[model samples]
Target: MVIGDGILTPCISDSIVWISAAILVGLFMVQRFGAGKVGYTFAPILCIWFLFISGIGVYNFIKYDPTVLKALNPKYIIDYFKRNSLDAWISLGGVILATTGAEALFADLGHFSVWSIQISMCCVVYPSITIAYIGQASFLRKNNDLVGDTFYKSIPGPVYWPMFVVSVLAAIIASQSLISDFLHNPTIPLSRVLPLCEIVHTSPKYAGQVYVPEVNYILMLACLGVTLGFRTTAKIGNAFGIAVVFVMSITSCLLVLIMIMVWKSSLLYIIGYVVVIGFVELIYLSSVLYKFKEGGYLPLAFATILMAIMLLWNYVYKRKYYYELNNKISPERLKEIATNEKICRIPGLAMFYSELVQGIPPIFEHYVKNVPAMHSVLIFVSKKSLPISSIPVEERFLFRRIDTDGVNVYRCVARYGYRDARSEEEPFEKILIERLKDFIREDLAVNEGERLEAVAREIEVLDQACFSGVVYLIGESEVVAKQGSNLVKKIVIDQAYNFMKKNLRQSNMMLDIPHARMLKVGMIYEL
Candidate 1:
């Protein structure tokens, strides 16, 4: 029997396990919210957990016999490998399973300063884990025939329960941090900017993280299975640690490559990064090879599936966007449009805004069909939002002037925040009004401020005029007929029409009015 095998051992208690799990989950939430918010509170809890575990490790280290230190020699690893090459490799596979979540380190980098994570790893995690490993080696030395999770069972009852709980919590927080990272930080911009990157209105919130409810729940389930399915620490540890090391090694290499490309970095920086990466990779790889066959496949399979899903989802989504984006207006066409508007002949300006920056937008067809009378047009192409905000008033709503034949073609756009009292001043509808005022003041020799006020009044009057007439499109009306008039369509149309009507009235801008010839355009397809 193992020397520590008695009723006083910690493995006999279940309550400590649950407590540890709860604390770890709480800390995980802290990490998820970010250090600025909940991390401070979580720090103490994490510290306590680490201290308690570290104490146990230290106790074992101090009590162990001196002979156990021999295992630290490089010859032990070399000799063991020669004697049991296949077994060693298989054990390493298990260690690879242990480190499965190591990839999350990069993902969680945003939550804390890089310095903090590195500090925590060096000062807390690495030291404690190494101490524990050393203690395990000591325990094995005292009992050569011992197997399985005997290392954990060797602890005194007072320490056993607390350690078990700590292990459970550590596993959970490690997994959850990865999920939160993906949700909050995606890798790409949500959309393109107009003319320049500066034209982008707002930065994407989730620049590197993604939130997939299905994946989250699946991970939770898997974690629970592993917890209950295999109740021993050593068994799970062997399989769980290797994957993290592999991911870390790969990312380290990737980081080095990225730095070289970005900075044309010095050889010293390259070498330093390589050494650190190499060390961690080597350590993890060695550990994994030490324990592969028992249960390493569990985390390996989990990571494989995770990566596959991420890649496949991105591929499918990108394909759909690319298909829709393929149709675009060329630079030559824009130049031709400028020429056709007679910028040399026009009196004012023609201002334009394209919500979609990738190509000439679907709305350009509307311009071709209407062919409004204008002199010079200054087309200000603007980017589009996904579904268009419902705000009543917006600065971008101002008017713009397009130059054509020296005459000005005025085009106004309105950008609204949403359907609320605040939206009245921010509507997209005022883009045209602002542009027209500027043209009148600068080009037409009108008082800048007074002319803008007058133009606003005129826009109000024209909008009132539109109330008397109905706005309609000209060609290809057959498609709406074929789509079938269902309850959902009716409900959507009614809501949209009502929303638009309310906003237009509030802005004093109507879509159709008397004597204004409610502008008609060609067929409409999915824009």
Candidate 2:
């Protein structure tokens, strides 16, 4: 593991961090174009780099002491422990740092296809890294005094400058990939503080590449902070090793479960696998934990805080959803309100946004109670994101007319795939009106002359309403814990969740609704 520390270390400095800081800023700035484009730009450079190291490794292996090959024997691992014991055990923290950002490569599999990842890792990465390690070991053994800067000193002279540039680029690319892994202090504040919107489809071809501008900046700042704080590869390697082992151990535990529960392996085989892999991970875990005061506690703190936030968010989310579910206005109640002549019918078109898919939201009741009148053409628009990529534009609007007494009330489900960008403000209303007109034509097509006349009249009303104006009505509610709630629940809802909600993307901003024509109906949710 120690042998894989550097393909070519560039004498990363403690005193001068601005160079690294600049590289990080530049790396994160390009994230708006997404990983696919970034990958395309950097892939060739990385391939060349791997090949260079691999070639250097092979050259050094033949030229230097061939006796170093004996170190490949498994006995050396056991012998090293016997010789140094506690010191060797402590060094496992640094040794494990060789695999830094490797787990991130696996986590970032969503940015690429399965076959591409497999081919690249197997054909290029693993082989190149192994050869580079062998070469470094052979050269270091031959020139024992150059052990301090193993990778750089071992490199052939003509390739040294190129290696330095490539190494820095490699580090940048690596940290770019590591962006998805959020650290605690920065992550919590950024997420709860910044009003950043998540841009899902940064690349038209890649659905999984998410670009949050605020997150990118926060991560950049965090990288700069970490770089400025630790100031060297050796010190930061403490955190790096912990992060790597945490991922590896979790992955192994999941794999073990899969092998036992899903694969239904034999008892003896399960025991063997657990004993071997578990022991190795525990060994590294303990070593990494020893450096907790140095840096290892970073990930641990991040996990604890993130987990708490998630749990609190989820708890409130479920309760609030159910509250909306149970309190949704039934069809009969909708008809009653629509038929009520005292509830004055206004002229323009009103689109009320809601979360409930089936029935009218409780907020509708709140709106009608406070406000005496509603628009002539009412639509309960619930924007839905399906678990897929890119819903077709023509099929995006699903118009279902509600049987509200003599009123043109509709339940318009604006469906979008997860990767689909929300439609523009003007087009959204225009498309819905057009789709509603088409829906009326289709429904009345199956009816008689009187129905056809009604259809024409309805379309005329819709057109007249559109020409008058379209107003987006949404309930902007303050979510809070009920009066009788416990202190913890109150804190979760009133403090943390509310803080996040306040800073999160606004509904009008999210839906691209025009602020001039938007009416915010405020209410309170005591969950």
Candidate 3:
């Protein structure tokens, strides 16, 4: 909408709206090629935007209203509030838009260094925005008739067209940052935090730089819908203001928690921080809330829907994890089953993908109990998510032998960082086999003199068996309400959870396992 307004002011054409939509669609369409390709192009344009605005601000500040500088004094703010209390407070909703890109700067910290951001904001962004606002106030003081389009009308005739072009470019660049953050940030309940799309990391150097084709198209369609629906920048600005204030208020609350828990700050410092920031945010929040009937309800409605989805997913996942924790079989039980002579031993290898790092998964026990037979080599592989950016290759897999009985049973834990890419080129089975081979070689080397011949023969037999075939077993578990449960539990577990599970990507597809050699052990969990 900002871009459309910019173009419409300078170009007197009936098709400007369509042109703006086309440009917005084009911006999203190029996202699949990755942000790194075009991110550098925005820097120079943004620099020019800041410089141009600062120059105009200085010119207007000197010529129109030198006395407008006195408005910066806090005394005037206090007097205005004293005279028109509620009106002054309601205008804060508009005041907060002046710092519009602050949150985006914080979100982009993963792409750039903290020092770089600090320097840019202090030297470039802060001074430019302050001067631009003062100049706009000065211009409005002299010419009240130009209040509707103060920004463009205040510009000098010679540079008006060029400034309009710059404004359009700036708007597009700002919108790009917002869309990128929405799709990339895992904390936002849009892409990674929800099962809305598959986030594919395009840059090996920067894990935060991702490309989500599904989200990109969805956002583009949404942009077009809003552009056609609202058809004016004023209504869109109201929605945008609500979104900005909500984000600021949420950030302030999260910051208070972080300072206490992560920073371990003093009580006095925490109180001071909250009092200062909380006061400002509360005023803006109230002001935006007051405008709920005038388009502010849109963002609040969207947030409510997103929050419900994230909470539902988290609830279902917790219930499933609790079930696994209670129903897991002990290692002794697995050993006894492996040692049982009555049960037949199959010829090939079986890799059971489980979530539990300790104890055998209930799916494995359920399978063997029904079949009364197990593979010659059984591996319980658990893929664990770590809290770091990337895990070292050498520390990727932790292999431990469970028993040395009739069938060689082992447990393998594969560690991955949240930011790490699960490359589809390397199948999990192939990686597991390579790690197992490495484990055998290390074992043989460690016990070179004690059981050299026995270890060599065992390695040869295991190699032949692994080469013969490998099967992947995964649990296709569903959460359901227990018998005699209440309606809410049934609706949440049996209806909502099951619906999401059926739509979300399956474990085998996510792990890149071949469908032909995969076996799904279906199970039901009543919680």
TM-score of each: 0.56, 0.90, 0.90
Model 2 poorest ten-residue lDDT run: 1-10
- TM-score winner between candidates 2 and 3: 2
Model 2 clash tally, residue pairs? 0
Query: Over all chains combined, what TM-score does candidate 3 have?
Result: 0.90
Q: Is candidate 1 or candidate 3 better by lDDT?
A: 3
Q: Write the per-residue lDDT of candidate 3 for residues 394-493, one digit (tens) a residue.
A: 6789998886563588899998765665566755666777788678667655555655775776667677768778888898786789999999989988
lDDT of each: 0.47, 0.75, 0.75
* Model 3, CA-based lDDT: 0.75
Q: Rank the candidates by TM-score, best first.
A: 2, 3, 1
Q: Write the per-residue lDDT of candidate 2 for residues 244-316, one digit (tens) a residue.
A: 7887888788888999889999999989998999999999999998998886666666566657766777677
Summarize candidate 1's per-residue lDDT along 123-224 as a digit string, tens digits: 887787677666766666676576566656657688788777675555444444444553443334322210011111111232223333333343444444
> How does residue 14 of candidate 2 score in lDDT?
25
**Which residue pairs in candidate 2 have backbone atoms (N, alpha carbon, C) closer than 3 angstroms, thus clashing?**
none
